[model samples]
Target: MAYDSIEDLLNNGGLKPGDVVSQRELMEKTGATLGAVREAIPRLEAEGLLITLPKRGLMVPSLDITFVRDAYQMRTMIEMTSVPFAIKHISKSVIAGWIDWHNSAIDHLDRGDEEVAQRLQRLDWDIHLQMVSAIGNALITNVYRVTSIKTRMVGQSRIRVTPANASRVIGEHLAFLNPLYAGDEVEATKALCQHIDNSLTLALGGTL
Candidate 1:
């Protein structure tokens, strides 16, 4: 709960990268007990989500170029490693379902449904998370979870999704999903790499 509250602050722009706040302030803002907030701090710091300054307060990570690049690079490495396992083990039905969800999400976004847009973002992460989990390694999955959070933070700080770009994003998802559904290992891997590269560019404030 405490960790989620802090993530909510970051995602909602209540807290930003490089912002510092005292322990009491965090407790108040998150509505968590001081002890709970304190307990959550070390985990967050370990994940590179935030850090403690000598006497200043807890500071969120600054979104510098190197930071963004490293986060996405780590993401690419972990995800690319998962691709073989995902392609081999993930069901065709599941891939089809994902393709359907992306298509539906695009339609909802076209209608200006903010709720669906938010859900679509979650689904985007879920798809990647599912791929990583397909490897069946708890340790790597845990590491990927932390990387995902950092990547999402970078993306939220930099990318603003408009209808035009949202459709484009879904299209990118389809680019890989269709090949995966067809059991084309080579094509799937290539398309997934391209999609991740596109995402990295967007996270770094580049256009598609």
Candidate 2:
């Protein structure tokens, strides 16, 4: 419960990168007991979500060029490694379902349905999680989970998915999903690489 509250804060922009927060502040914001907050600290630190200072409060990771690069690189490595396994193991029906969701999401975003847009964001993460989980390695999945949280933090802090760019975002997802659904490993890999590169470019504010 405490972990969930922390994640909620992170996702909702209540907690941002480089924010130093005390335990009592965390307890108040998350509505978790003092003991619960303390217990969750070690796990949060272990996952790279929090850093303990000598005397100051816990600090969220700062968003820097290096941090963004490393986070995305780790994401690319883990996700690319899972592509082959995902291609072989993931069902065509599941891929089709995702494709359908993306298509619908594009329409909803066009109509300015922010609720659908939010759901689309969750779906985007789910697609990646499903792909990675297909690798069947608990350790890799666990590592990916941490990497994903960091990547998400960077994205949330740096990128804003407005209606103008929402379609492009969904389109990027389809770039790989289409090929994967068709069972074309080479095309899927190429498209996935391009998509990640595009995402990184956007995350860097189009500088890189």
Candidate 3:
């Protein structure tokens, strides 16, 4: 049997931290075969998204704030170090696209659409990743992408987009994007540092 889709099980808020769900119960609810359910549980466990008890079976994992902070810190270092190189290699069109994205994000904020606003927020972050990847370091890009996904998951659990905060975030992103578009390597690096610093500050504050 194939592994059960973990995303499916996470629906409806039924799986709480430390609340175990036996294999039989999982199978009954998901219609997933026993073999599939068994295989998927361990994967989730290894990812720190789930845990298993000796007799009670598997449950969602508890949030670890320390791990979240450490993850953000690690990502900040990796992405920041990539910036100077990215500024050197990134294209004019690419930088312009980033500016466009930030401008569009601002529009979303003005409209007060929280879901779209949140999505635009993530895309704004991706602008930095795209810049990094353009440095043509496959190994660095791959490693950072893995950590990025983890950070995003942790962020989703903790952050919600409000109109006020979204507007502020859009402003912050433009501050970073403008320097990069002008090919101002020194200022671009500074902007990236500030952007990462603000994010680290928020993550440490448990505001994600």
Candidate 4:
């Protein structure tokens, strides 16, 4: 596979942040040949996903202050700017589906369904991305995609699952949904910003 594909593979659950990885291990795990692994490494390195160090060839970089800061900042920018267009373009059915999924996630979390509750975290991501896409700006959508990938990588690599954090995450998403469904763009924007801020605080190793 190519580096872009490799990046997707890793993002799809192949590699974890801060994990020390080797060429051979990557080749085997990803089913890519040595050549493909070599090609992908440099690109991954450029993306801040990989870190080169003395005596330790390469490592999946840990979620550091820079990545965390940048991720939250870019995310906020995309979410806030996309709101006006999203309010205009996103169909009611799509909004309803998002609402249904989010409500299910809340129910699952309340019932202590760890597996579904954990997977529910992704709903927050999907809702925001869908909103951005509703704006119909290919340029902005694609740019936000890179931010999405980076954010996903950091969360997957570093964030941990805990009851308090999970509850807070659920609450944050729920906070955004009300204003969105009400078609109150201003309040929706505020909720989205608060959600990102909360996420930034949580990314500090879940201290929040």
- Best model per lDDT: 2
- Can you tell me which runs of candidate 1 are displaced by over 4 Å? 160-162
Q: Write the per-residue lDDT of candidate 4 for residues 1-208, one digit (tens) a residue.
A: 6666656655655676667867877777778788988887876777677777667666876666787688788778878998888778887677777767766666566667767655665565567778888888888886777666766667763453444356767667767776787788888898889877766766666655
Model 2, residue pairs in steric clash: none
* Whole-model Cα lDDT of every candidate shown, in order: 0.81, 0.83, 0.66, 0.71
In model 1, residue pairs whose N, Cα or C atoms come closer than 3 Å (at least 3 residues apart or on different chains), thus clashing, are: none
Better of 1 and 2 by TM-score: 2
Between prediction 1 and prediction 3, the one with superior TM-score is 1
Q: Which ten contiguous residues of candidate 2 have the minimum total lDDT?
A: 157-166
| Strongest candidate by TM-score | 2
C-alpha TM-scores of all predictions:
0.86, 0.89, 0.67, 0.74
lDDT of 3 by residue, 1-208 (tens): 3343454344224454446778878777777788787877766666565667777777665545686777777777777777777777777787788678767767767777778665765576567678768778888786666455455455553343466677767777778778877877778777777777776666556443
Q: Which ranges of candidate 2 are over 4 A from the true structure?
A: none
lDDT digits (tens) for residues 1-208 of candidate 1: 9988987787656787778999899999999999999999998988788889998999988766787788778888888888778888899889899998887786678887777766666677788889999999999998888776766666774554555467877887898889878877788788888988987888878875
lDDT for model 1, on a 0 to 1 scale?
0.81
The list of candidate 3 runs beyond 4 A from truth reads 1-60, 135-139, 152-158, 206-208
- Model 4 TM-score is 0.74
